[model samples]
Target: MNKLIEQQIETLVEPLVSEKGLELVNVEYVKEGAHWYLRLYIDKEGGVDMDDCTDVSHAVSEMLDTKNPIPQAYMLEVSSPGLERPLKKEEDFKRFQGSLVMVHTLSQFQGFKKFSGTLVGLINDEIVLEYENKRVAIPRDLVKKTHLLLDF
Candidate 1:
């Protein structure tokens, strides 16, 4: 059921995102506590603003009403991924080179579960991280989560 809803949302959002000159980072339909929330993460070269989010939300809401993919009432949210955007794709990694990043590993490395350091580079499907005055090469697949950290 969740997969069906995700598919429908993707179908409905792709066109709107492209028309708005934004990239669809991710779409999630999940039940949190007693409420179901549909979140849409959008991005662009310069980043997204409130107007962009509102526009996408309005367009997506109208389309979802017509499609009727979700059975229950859900609050739809459209917003920027913020300073700590999830590095969900290879393109994101490439796009955010030389930025501070926080990464969690599926398996512990260096006796630590998380690494917060400079994103040195990506080479051959591996992420090179500079941490603790040393360089660590972690397999991209082993990363559970990777997000850009704001310096401020």
Candidate 2:
């Protein structure tokens, strides 16, 4: 049910987001305690500002009202993906090469499930990373989550 909602929302908002010169990073519909939250993570070449979020929210809200896809009440949030942006697609991996990243695997790799290193991009079906003084190649399928690490 949640997947269906997310797909519907994605289909409905992709065009709107593109029109605003934004990339639709991800869409999530989840329940938190007693409340349901619909979050839209958007991005651009630089970043997103309050005006961008407000515009998207207004546009999406109007579309949702007319379509009425969701039955229950939910809080809709449109915002940037932030500094620790998720690296989900192959393009993302290539684009963010040389950037610092943190990867979590579904199972232990080299006796560890988590690794932080400089992203060396994808080679074949593996994600190459420079960790410590060595290079580690992680199978794409083993990756549970991969995101950029913001160094402050």
Candidate 3:
């Protein structure tokens, strides 16, 4: 996946997503086997249905066609983030506080690269978690991914 392209798509699609009363959860531009894919994960307070995905896909597809940001051919996919929702923004940490989450760091922290615990919150550029009955504060800069850990 190209992070740069994903970032660019996020920048371009966020407003349209917001306009449609949705939160743009995540974006990815990746190659799988012989095909390239651009995926957009969106959400709302009540979660989204297939119709929502199709509507957003059409809107986003038209936008991308107008902009032509990616030079190569790729399939566009729009869908919900699912049960294990990603924590991608500061607000997400605050919103999902007290939820179980798995966070992956760019570098090892306390001899480990991943931490799973209850999300305390993001404070002062650090993500605080209650892991194994202890409070662990991880620098946000080092966090590569953070997502809800489904208890089910």
| Ordering by lDDT | 3, 2, 1
Off by over 4 Å in 1: 1-8
Q: Which tens-of-lDDT digit does each residue in 1-152 have in candidate 1?
A: 88688878888789889998999988889999999999999999889999999998888889888988888999999999887888867887888888899889999977888888888878888888887899888888888888899898
Structural RMSD, model 2: 1.8
Backbone clash count, each prediction separately: 0, 0, 0
Clashing residue pairs, backbone N/CA/C < 3 A, model 1: none
Candidate 3 global TM-score: 0.95
| Clashes, model 1 | 0
| Residue pair clashes in candidate 3 | none
Per-residue lDDT over 51-152 for candidate 3, one digit per residue giving the tens place of the 0 to 100 score: 989999999999999999998999999999999989988889989999999999998988999999999999898999997789999998899999999986
Query: Per-candidate TM vs. native?
Result: 0.82, 0.88, 0.95
How much lDDT does each candidate structure score? Answer: 0.87, 0.93, 0.94
* Model 2 alpha-carbon drift over 4 Å, by segment: none
TM-score between model 1 and native:
0.82
Taking the tens digit of each residue's C-alpha lDDT, what string does model 2 give over 1-89?
99899999999999999998998988889999999999999999879999999999999999999999999999999999998989987
- Index of the highest-lDDT prediction: 3
